[model samples]
Target: MSKIEEVKAKVEIGKTKLVPALVQEALDEGSTPAMILQAMVDSMGVVGDKFSKGEIFVPEMLIAAKAMAKGVDVLRPLLAGDSETSLGTCIIGTVAGDLHDIGKNLVAMMIESAGFTMVDLGVDVPAEKFVEAIKENERVTLVACSGLLTTTMPALKEAVQTIKAAYPDQKVIVGGAPVTPEYAAEIGADGFAPDAGSAAVKAKEIISV
Candidate 1:
């Protein structure tokens, strides 16, 4: 198999050593940092699909993310340390009144692993914060809302409406335990994600389409 394909397979199998070793190989072969980054990102995309389908669980996802991060760390400086220019920017957070952040954090990592620059606002993010981030960061095209609880889920709707009202072209994507695609549509969100891996895919879809 080709080197990139080998790296992708290793990532799918959740091998922690795969990325770092393949990164070294890529560097030795005089592959550009950009090429290596794209390979790693593609691997993460594969991992995301497997995760969404339940072929891989959270622990495996974390392991693959860690590997991807290691590869990125090695290539960061060589790429001029510009994560945003290389990977499109994205804003993500747990919606207001929701203190739980495990799911949000996972989604952030998965997105980052897929080579999207992430602005993680953490938990309890108000609707205004989402709008402010979108306005300030024009590079940020995708906004992800996560709420683990039913009570705090309304924040997703509020944030989506507030952002869309301010920028009619904006796209808001909602996820978390209590969120559904129908509910996302009802709230005027652009998309819904069933899991963190799917969230990464959904973010890419919104940005590309």
Candidate 2:
């Protein structure tokens, strides 16, 4: 099989140590950086699908993401770094009073695998911090607000409202256990995702429009 296909296969199987070398080999074999990166990205889509379908779990998904990340490192220099070919920059965080990060971290990885440059602001992030991060970052195309607890749903709404007020045209996506499509729309979010895999798909869909 071709080196690019091998890279894809290894990445899908969560072969973290082998993917980097295979990616480098693919490059040496005349495969373009975009070709190799796209191969890895496609593999990530497969992994995400499995997770969404319950065929795999979080540990497996994390391992695959880590493997793809290793492969990405090999291509970064040739690709002009991670975000050069990305859909755009995505600023993500868990809204204020919410210290939960497992869900937020998963969504961040899934979105990054989908080719958006991720700027993770971490947990317990204030509503104002989301706006501040947008102002502080470059090429900010999307903002993601996450809230795991029902109590923090208000903080999630505030985050969306704060961002929309700052940049009316900016795309913002909200998600987590307590966030619903109705709530997402009610708060003026451009999109809503129910889980990490779907979050990546919705992120790409919203950002494209």
Candidate 3:
């Protein structure tokens, strides 16, 4: 098979150690840096879909993301001049009264892979902090809020509402264990994703519109 396809396959299986070398090999074989990068990104998209479908769990998904990260590291130098996927800065954080981070971290990585510059606010983030991040960051095209609990769901709503109150047109996407599309709509979020994989897709969709 071609080096680019090999890179994609290795990344999907989470071959963290092998993906870098394969990416380099693909570069050696005359594959353009952009094409190789897209291969890895597409691999993550496949991995994400599997995660959303329950075919794989967190460890598997994280492994694939790490593999893609390794490949990206190999291509980062060559890609310095290629600003094609820059969707602008995205602010992400878990809502207040909740400390869960695995989901948020996963979403952050996937969203970054999809080309947005991520500013992660980490866990237990208060509502105003989301707005504060938007105000502080440049070209903030999207804000992503995560909540992993039923109780902290209100914090998610509060966070989205606060950001909307401050910046009515700010695009917000919400997700986590307890978040639903209906709830996201009620909370004034621009979008809702069911899992980390779809979060990247949702982030891109929110930014594009």
Best by TM-score: 2
lDDT digits (tens) for residues 100-185 of candidate 3: 99889999988887778899999999999999999998889999999999999889999999999999999999999888899899
Off by over 4 Å in 3: none
Mark the 10 consecutive residues where model 3 has the least summed lDDT.
Answer: 79-88
Best by lDDT: 2
**What lDDT score goes with residue 144 in model 2?**
90
What's the candidate order when arranged by decreasing lDDT? 2, 3, 1
State candidate 1's TM-score: 0.90
Predictions in order: lDDT: 0.82, 0.92, 0.90
TM-score of each: 0.90, 0.97, 0.92
Taking the tens digit of each residue's C-alpha lDDT, what string does model 2 give over 99-134?
999999999999999888899999999988999999
On lDDT, the stronger of 2 and 3 is: 2
Model 3 lDDT, full chain set? 0.90
lDDT of 1 by residue, 13-99 (tens): 667776778877878877777887877788888888888899889998898888878777778778775654445678998888989
Q: Write out the backbone clash pairs for model 3.
A: none
Candidate that beats the other on TM-score, 1 or 3, i.e. the better one: 3
